[model samples]
Target chain A: MKARVTVTLKTGILDPQGKAIEGALKSLGVAGIASVRQGKVFDIELAGADPAQAEAALKDAADKLLANTVIENYNIEVRS
Target chain B: MKARVTVTLKTGILDPQGKAIEGALKSLGVAGIASVRQGKVFDIELAGADPAQAEAALKDAADKLLANTVIENYNIEVRS
Candidate 1:
């Protein structure tokens, strides 16, 4: 089974790294960019075929370690 | 317009951060684990609704600033 978790900053949060990227993009002549918000992607290979169990484990992992829930939000998807 | 850029390290590359996270997850009692790899996600808001143009701009942005193409591979998706 394969699982992916995406963690992103919540709205109204200041993202300096994203700002830096946006500025860098403009300087590189890549126009049409208004804003950029950066986040994290985690790809995991699990040992089971049970989607429900895998999703539960991944959600727990996201809550416990993968994300800082106060400042960021995380979503999980499992594929078998 | 909206675009998403996913940047991930290529295979065989040394990812110390990902290794550390894997160890952390193990310590946190996240079982059924085989392996973990960490990457980056960028959510971009563009000024134009043209999906093709937005996709091109985001791909350029990812190539130039969002990702180090030498060690990383980036995927770009544009949504209108």
Candidate 2:
């Protein structure tokens, strides 16, 4: 199974990277960009085939290592 | 309007960060782990409400600044 974990900044968190990207976009002549927030995505391929187990393990990984819970939130999607 | 851009390393690209994360997960006792790949996600807000325009602008942004076309691929999703 494969699990995709998307880790994103919480609302109201300061994202300097996002700000920089927004500025870069504007300078590159890509118009109408209002705001930008950056995040991380983890694509994990597990040895196991069970969807439920993969989801649980991915959630554990997210909580333990993939995300900073105080400032970031993560969503997990499993594919078999 | 909102646009999401997910930037991922192309196949056969070396990802040290993903390896490090996989090691970390193993050390943290998450079982059945195999391989991991990391990517970037950008959540963009557009000033315009038009979905078509937002998608186009986001694609432009991704090509110009958000992604390295040689070693990365990006997918853009627009929401109004």
Total backbone collisions for each predicted model: 0, 0
lDDT at position A70, candidate 1: 95
Please give each candidate's TM-score.
Answer: 0.96, 0.97
lDDT of 1 by residue, A1-80 (tens): 99899999999989999999888888889999999999999989988888998998898899999999999999998878
Reference-based lDDT, each prediction: 0.90, 0.93
Clashing pairs in 2: none
Q: How do the residues B1-80 of candidate 1 rate in per-residue lDDT, one tens digit apiece? A: 88789999999998889889888989999988778899999999999888888888887788778889899999888777
- Where does the lowest 10-residue lDDT sum fall in candidate 2 chain B? B50-59
DockQ per candidate, 2 decimals: 0.93, 0.93
| Whole-model lDDT, model 1 | 0.90
The true-versus-predicted C-alpha distance at residue A38 of model 1, in Å, is 0.3
Docking class of 1: high
